[model samples]
Target: MEIPIMFEESDAVEGHHDGLVISLPVAKEHGSSANIIMLDTLKHMNIDEKNIIIKSTMLVGFSGETKKTSGEITLATYAKGVNLQVKFLVIDTLSSYNIILSRPWIHEIRAIPSTYH
Candidate 1:
């Protein structure tokens, strides 16, 4: 089995959005449970399929070789919704797991509230 290394979610929110973050432990030994956890997480988060983006980061072995992969899926191809932006972040570890889901928060500048004397 393969394990995740890191998973994090930002407090970002948008229209009709779904986000998933998953992390698993890394092992010096090969064949960890991380891969399975990642797949399961993806399956669980993928509601429409078209609007999902899967970003995966993997670190393995005693040498700690890290790999990064990303892909985008469109729910429209599956006859689901159109232009939905669902983000998925997966990290594999060898000992632990972490998962987070949050809306994509956008930062904007606004004037401070005026104080009355």
Candidate 2:
């Protein structure tokens, strides 16, 4: 039920076109649902289905508490005016990992923070 932080130096970057990587833990109970939800969320966000990619890998460690079963999902796509690059979503079920969201070009038209007023 806990989310751990997972990221590597290579995965981190500052730019819209730069590749963005995200990692998260997938519990056996919620793994399937999590994947579905994630994909649905992306679709809702208007991301092209062809641009998204998903993959799974096995991670080995000495932690007895570790699930020994982990998986990663990478979502890469481009956005207009965003200098789009690559975005990744990773899930480590055993470690209760974290999900990182990144983008290169995030612009705020009004620095004052838009208010409905």
Candidate 3:
């Protein structure tokens, strides 16, 4: 099945949700800056902050033990007639992409990423 792609600009990323947030390439050789969501992004998406999961270890760098960010928020994706809820950590910085999908979200949605289109 070929999945449709949707992009949005929320002072953050402008790419498909793909069940996971994907940040632009960071300074590293083959890594990204950060895979986090901003407060404004959540507000723009109209996702309530209370619904966020707080701290998620699914994030690449997060340990999911201590409180790292202000908090996390939950955002729902309506794609292919499916309503999926995703948790995002709230950040206050800037990057090429605002949000990046983590392992948890990808696993939840059971999605696979392709680079050779």
lDDT of each: 0.32, 0.34, 0.51
Per-residue accuracy of model 3 over 1-117 as CA lDDT, tens digit each: 978764434434445454433333222112023336766666666556675666643334435433246666655554333456655567654545556666665555555554322
TM-score of each: 0.24, 0.24, 0.47
- Candidate numbers, best TM-score first, in rank order: 3, 2, 1
Report the candidate with higher lDDT, 1 versus 2. Answer: 2
lDDT of 2 by residue, 1-117 (tens): 756545555654444453333333322212011322244444445645565445553433336332222223344333332322333443333222233232221221111211121
The order by descending lDDT is 3, 2, 1
For model 2, the local distance difference test gives: 0.34
lDDT (C-alpha) at residue 65 in model 3: 39
Residue 40, candidate 3: Cα error in Å is 2.8
RMSD of 3: 11.7
Which runs in model 3 stand beyond 4 Å of their true positions? 1-35, 46-67
lDDT of 1 at 28: 14
lDDT of 1 by residue, 13-56 (tens): 43523333322222211103222234344455544334346655
